[model samples]
Target chain A: MAIKVLHHGLATTVQDLGRPGYFHLGIPVGGAMDRYAMRAANLLVGNDEGAAGLEAVFIGPKLEFTEDALVAVTGADMPTKVDGVAQPGWTAFKVKAGQTLTFDFLKSGARICIAVSGGIDVPEALGSRSTYPIGALGGYKGRPLTAGDELPVGKSNLASEGRNVPEALRRRPGPSAELRVLPGLYWHRVTEESQQNFFADEWKVANEADRMGYRFKGGRKLDFVDREQPFGAGSDPSNIVDSCYPYGSIQVPGGTEPIILHRDAVSGGGYFMVGTVISADMDLIGQLQPHSPTRFVKVTMEDALAARRVRQLNLARLREALA
Target chain B: MSARYTFGGDEHLFVECSEEMSLEAFFTSLSMAKGVRESGIKGVTEICPANASLQMKFDPDVIHPNDILKEVKAIEGAAARAEPVLKTRIVEIPVFYNDPWTHETLMRFRERHQDPTGTDLDYAARINGYGAVDDFVGAHSGSPWFVSMVGFVAGLPFMYQMVERQRQIQVPKYLRPRTDTPKLTVGHGGCFGCIYSVRGAGGYQMFGITPMPIFDPTQTTSYLRDFMVFFRPGDIVKFKPIDRDAYDQAVEDVDKGRFAPPIREVSFDLREFQKDIDGCNAMLEGMLNGH
Candidate 1:
């Protein structure tokens, strides 16, 4: 099976769960930012969790399926249409031969994952099929999916095994305001006021935000003696001292604004990691669209763990339901 | 620059577990911790290098944040009392220092530095060179150089922060920060900050080339993800610079399996085409894996 890319949306590219442990090699983990949604979509279409699929940002593309295909779109609740007919989100649908799928303006979230039944058959790079746009490597020719790009589908009958996106899993996303975080690698470095304000304040996603990092505006500016600090934005005049791989919530310099690292964040960073959005809450942050106001909530490690436990149980339930 | 530096307490969490200790002592104490031994944290994770400081990654479900704090407090003394296994191996890296800065580049660096004294300019040029002395010279006459952190990107290792004197003469960043710049340059050939998975434009200064491949996907054991790097927040590094011939010999030895990268470690040194070499290992991984 194959699908012709009629119009590549804002920033569409094929991604999977992303490559980990390679951060030390100067490779960013460029994968589905909203992994939870990506997995759900893959399951909806009877594909494995790590299947290569389209991570369409802003809006999805118009595609023409050459043969019958089963597809599912997850993440955003945008206005998606099939052959000029409104289609529902979070469900599997069969596109007959020569069917055209198009997406309208985004109603929420920055991106969505479109998983076809027989996962995209792109050549693997380092055991993954994610795209790294900056270096022009990986994914559909090492770049975002472009108009007229033809993607071949792996020969598999996985779609015959029907899977469903449970109603609970299909629950509409919550308010884009409050964000949850665990104390960062250097959370204590910020002033108490800054820390308090960080959680209390609402910051708008700056225009500069991208897969590399989400640069936000208006938390609290750091007030420290302008000595050559080693962490954060503009902290070091030279290159950042190799430190640790980013685990999300790496605070770039200028503590005035905080950056929530995303899937494509570099492995090691010099900036002080102000806080990491807990694993359970990371998908929430990932789904946030630009200009969405977000606030940080300091969850104790216990709470973070509890949240993860809930998510784990939820995943188990999802798998059982699919089975 | 040596004005008594008193770190602000409110801003930073400074848990002084020891007044003075060697890398061996620190490692020993950490390796023998109760949490690591009893909590089953060791087997659960890949590499947990116990050094002067044991940076434990907590799974929120298994370990609470407060529990980690309690663990840190309870283990600080244990880490202090413990001793490290001191079986050290010296990995010789090959390097070729390339002068990429033209007159314009030099001028830009000069303009970036607020105080462009001759010494400052010299220091900018020395970024490539100074890293070598700082890592190998024992940080000032037999002073033990501690391994501050083991960074990713072929596991580029960072020894310690620059000395107070070396901090005085530093270069300024160019007008635009290049995110795709490779982590290692002339001096700190084995330094971290190399991107192993993602390739992007960066602005780190480039100087030398190292023949010892820091990373190569063709090697069977190479997995940007599986190879766990060994270095802790406070392990000691004995930096020793090797010339071009030694670098070539090291590469030859590595290729022949005389020095194959361990199942946990990956390393590379860019001694030629400073720009491309920095990202070669990561670029190769991406290309090899179809990332």
Candidate 2:
């Protein structure tokens, strides 16, 4: 009926595909950062792709299954174990009543998703169970799960253990990643030389990476075109009138670092946005570790659309392989 | 009116109605968002109408981005003719100006402030040409402000004063972003007043704290039983300054589920207000006082 928390991970929260229609109200589409992994894990456990699951960051949570259930862990290269017995990543396995689940040191990635056969049954808020700690909405009490909390589980459709996803199908960041971006309207605010340098320079994922945004450092600071500061804007060159920040939009606060907003981003702000990372690359961002080297590649609108199609086809292939 | 339409990414189309923040820009964004919604544009997962701008999140796979762009441009053209009027509510928000919570927080992050020697309220007052904090508070609470945008965090409303441009209070943000701001803390920056719905990072110049909840995700507050978010984009707010005893009493009433926010439904016409700015604001305030 429930999964009792033994040891809460560094930051484990309930997530689904997220509530999508509330951004105008400053509500982000709060969900698993690595959405592809969440869908894959749910598929392995025979649950709906968008079913609520536990998204743990860096460290894994110690959980005790109160009843027999099927579970799958996906996203990172973390070693999973039940009752101290090793289990394969991206493969559904069975855990008996009173059995404990734990994890070893993270091998490569920054996050992991554990999808149970019966999805985590947290009550829906704004049509989602995703935890948005900023607004204190959804999930287990609108924050990270803590020790001694019993998480309710939904009714299962039943799946046998040993359902495995192919190795290549499981996406993780390599030593370096090239995130494609499409420059938007605010791109003009930045100097032309700086725009070219942005693509030329390499960037490293700063420690500021989280559900809200991924800050990239180790790159040359961007220069702006000198202009009289607009009314209702800050004196800094990087400031714009407070505006909406679309998911994946790269905002350079003070022109120093580019923070690529992710799932739990604030709806609007005053920073100048240079561009937005293509949607196809956002899931890969969630798996990138701190200090991971990265590059920005500019793409046209057509190229972006093509990449999105490729991602859709990839998900389709995943569904077919699981079916 | 002019707008720049650009692709945010494969999934989102960002439309900047203006480069500067103005009531006209906000009205255009609201109208465009309404146009797109009424057009029933397919594949639009979300439409965010921000200050001076708007964004639409669409699934390119369903309706191609190019197609949506064409449709949105057509909608924008038609929206130009639409009347700029809104049926919104006016709510009286009780604020304890120079409250202890925001005062402590502002003092903690003074190094980030341009004038570190003075409190945020004092600094905000001094720069705006007020000799006393009471006169500043009177100016702030005298006029009903329009909710220009509701964002930066959940249910936090960014407001513009009802007064004309010359009388507007403008202040710079923190020299550096602060790591924290008290929840329900009333803040001002870049000619906009904002209420921090929850405790988190902020860069605004803090002035006061509100006893009433601006946003409650749990839907537990007495006034928020119907909706978790208390403010919307088109709402009007009048800040009513209160003493320490009323602030404490309001908090107690909230705990007992007896605090009902002062709200009144009213019709607002943009052109009407612009024609008689002071007169309309006085009328609006009178309506709220009667409520």
Candidate 3:
């Protein structure tokens, strides 16, 4: 069974956890920015955590199911309705054929994840079903879900009755709060005052936020301490060099504002990385809408690890429950 | 340190522990570990080219992610004590500041300050003594650089300094960002890193163009290193200049090479990318049909 695209509102595309380990190929890990929500929705529908789903940014599309299927919606609060009736969040629903699923304007957060039973059947590209629009390599023709696109779904006889995501596990509000971070690659190069501003002040998301990175409008430009080339530029300053880039890396060029890289960011960059948002807190960053207030909250390494452990334990339990 | 091996799959495995650590330090540690190579992770197709996260694609049939997570944690722990691996090169570029008008327009008071008696010119005078430009640019060769990150184009490594200098250059705001800034031109007013490979729009006040190829596509590995970059953690890199002849020799081959087949015309590909326009109709068919 497949779902017919009635109208793809805003920017909707197929995204999984993401495509990682291919920075060398010039590909960023373009996946669900809020991976937690993605997993939640997937688990609710009994699909594998890595199954392909819709990453509905801003307002979601009006989707019409062509066949009876189990689906769930999570992440970000969009005004969701089925046949004009208000729908709930983070639980699987059996939608009959021809039933229309409509999502109005997003009330909070930037993106929402929709998972269907048997997962969205998109052709895998380079080992992933995630869409990378820039390279046109993955997902539905490597592009955003459009108004007329039809998406296929694989068959699965697994009962949807048991795969429901519990109410306690639903994504709660507070993702718009301060982001936790680790000191960046070149944190020392920045002025002490800049460090204070980074933590203490609320930064506004600049107009330049995209899948690649988020540029913030804030006080203080992180500058290099020395004029000499720091390192990593192979003998010349041309285009190609052997290099690797990390996630949540904040690159500051000559601009006063800083750009924080996200899921679809490039594999390499030539600017100074003043800091990286902590992995545990990166999901919060994914939910930040434009002009959303963001602050960097510094955490010890131990705290970050503990937070990760908590999340891992949660995921492990879900898997064990499925088993 | 063994003969290389390649793993296959579509799963991304990251150290859940990367939250509070230095991204530079994190990758540096990974590069130093052993048995973290391809064989250890059976389903991992490739290691992503990123500093902050270690991405690996794996096939679910071959290896389950939960089983691999245990090994990934071990690799993360092993990375802490490993010596840093360096993926940085200190290449010095020559700049003549050939335009006298540009110099006069930019720094009008420099000639008067050249006198030995002038206190204002003391810094320049000290640097001018005994092949100073050569000596200054050459100073970078001895120091090692850390491969901080990569992107802009493939293999464009951004390195960082572990130490501070006595005098740091201030980057003045660009008076104008040229919409059509030529590629390969280094910006004026600052010694920003070179755009080694020439492909896209540049913002730097381009001083001059070097006649060498910044990136090479012919090599077996498109990216320079497999595990880590050229520079280790906490290393320094200083630039050293190459003469015109050396630069020419390095770039000549790529300049004359023919485009590989399955190579669609650059114009067509660009049009496909800009599909919203009406004139792009010629390319939209390829986009819709999953070409």
Candidate 4:
């Protein structure tokens, strides 16, 4: 019924599929950064795909269950142990009362999604259990979990112990990732040579990357076409009149480091957005770790849609197999 | 004017009504957004109308991106032929200018400011060609501002003053953004005024602080019981200058869960406002102040 936290590692919080439909009022669509991994973890534990789960970044928490439960961990290749016994990820296993769960150093990826048999039963705010800590809303008390906080788990009737995701379906973290993007909007604002260089360079994820945005370094300084800035627009050459920033939009302020606005980013801003990471590749961004190299590949709208269809089909197949 | 339609990846459609910030463009965007919402497009998930543009998030699986684009275009075409009548609310917000908290914060981040030697108000007043800070403050509070967009954070409204181009007050943002800003601090940057709903990093020139909470996630206040956010795009806001005594009283009322912003319902005609900006603003201000 409850899980007691012994050690809160790095940043850990409850997240689900996010609260959509309120971006107009400036509420960010906050949720698990790695949607695919979160769904997979929930499926492995016999929970609904959108069930609330714990998303831990950098490090993982040490948790002790008060009642018997089944749990699964997905996304990162974090070395985990149950009651001091090593356990494999991407699979569910039973844990006895008072058994402690902990993780070792991360081998790859930046986040880990842990799904309890029943979802983390936190009060839903704005129709989501996800946390927006800046606004102090949703999740467990609208903030990251701390040591000694007890989280309540929902009731589950399915016998899900020992369920596992196939190795083919498991996503492995890599040193580099290719993100597909549809270039438009303010893409024309950048010089043709700079636009070409943006796709040509292999950028490394900066340490400042987080849920708000992913800043990439080592790319050539992007240059914008010189023009008198319009009224109301800031003096920065990279700034446009304040406009709506789509989720996954990429903007290069000062034409230096390119930042990809993410799940918890500001809904709109004055910066010129050159491109947006397609829905299919957004999951890959969630898996990108600091210092990981990433290449932005321009893809056609048709190809992006095709990739999305394939992703949906794969998710459906996984759900069927688990059922 | 025609709108420039572009795609923001596969999930969003970005519609630019105008290159410059204008009430006519905003009204057009707002009207088209309303049309789209009323049409009940199958896949449309979120509609965000900004200063002079609109961004819509849709599910490609539910409806083809091209189809949504077509529907929005059709809606825009129809909206363009019709006069825009905006149902709006005039909100009177109390602000204590040069309050100690924001003053302390602004002074602390002076190194990030354009003029590191003087306070933000003095710099802003001087740059706007005002002899004294009082004149600048008077000019700012004299006119009502239209909420062009609600973004940058939850419940944060970006406002543009309703005035002639020459009368508009403009100020540049900080040379570098400050790492911290106090919540409820009224700030101005470029040509927009905003109330920091939740304090975080900000680059705007700090001016004053408001006691009324624009955002209450707890919904403890009666005004925020139904909606956690206070302002919506298209709302008119007038910042009323207040003294320390009034500010403290308002703070006390807020602490006691009794403070509510003064608001009145009004219909805004875009064509009328465009014809006479001063007259329209005066009428709106009169309605708000009950003069």
**Candidate closest to the true structure, highest DockQ:** 4
What TM-score would every model get versus the actual structure?
0.69, 0.98, 0.59, 0.98
Model 3: CAPRI class: incorrect
**Candidate 2: segments with Cα more than 4 A from true spot:** none
Q: Compute the lDDT of residue B28 as modeled in candidate 3.
A: 41
i-RMSD per candidate, Å = 8.8, 1.0, 10.0, 0.8
List DockQ for all candidates: 0.12, 0.85, 0.09, 0.87
**Model 1 CAPRI quality:** incorrect
Docking class of 4: high
Best by lDDT: 2
TM-score of chain B of each: 0.47, 0.98, 0.45, 0.97
Q: Which model, 1 or 4, shows the larger lDDT?
A: 4
Tens digit per residue, CA lDDT, model 2, A145-264: 999999999999889899889877878657788999999858998899999999999999999999999999999999999999888877888989888998999999889999999999
Off by more than 4 A, model 3: A161-163, A223-243, A317-323, B1-291
Ranked candidates (lDDT, high to low) = 2, 4, 3, 1
The 10-residue segment with the lowest total lDDT in model 4 chain B: B18-27
Superposed Cα deviation of residue B126, candidate 2 (Å): 1.1
Error of 2 at A74 (Å): 0.8
The residue-by-residue lDDT of candidate 3 on B234-286, one tens digit each, is: 22223334455544553453355532111111122222322443344223223
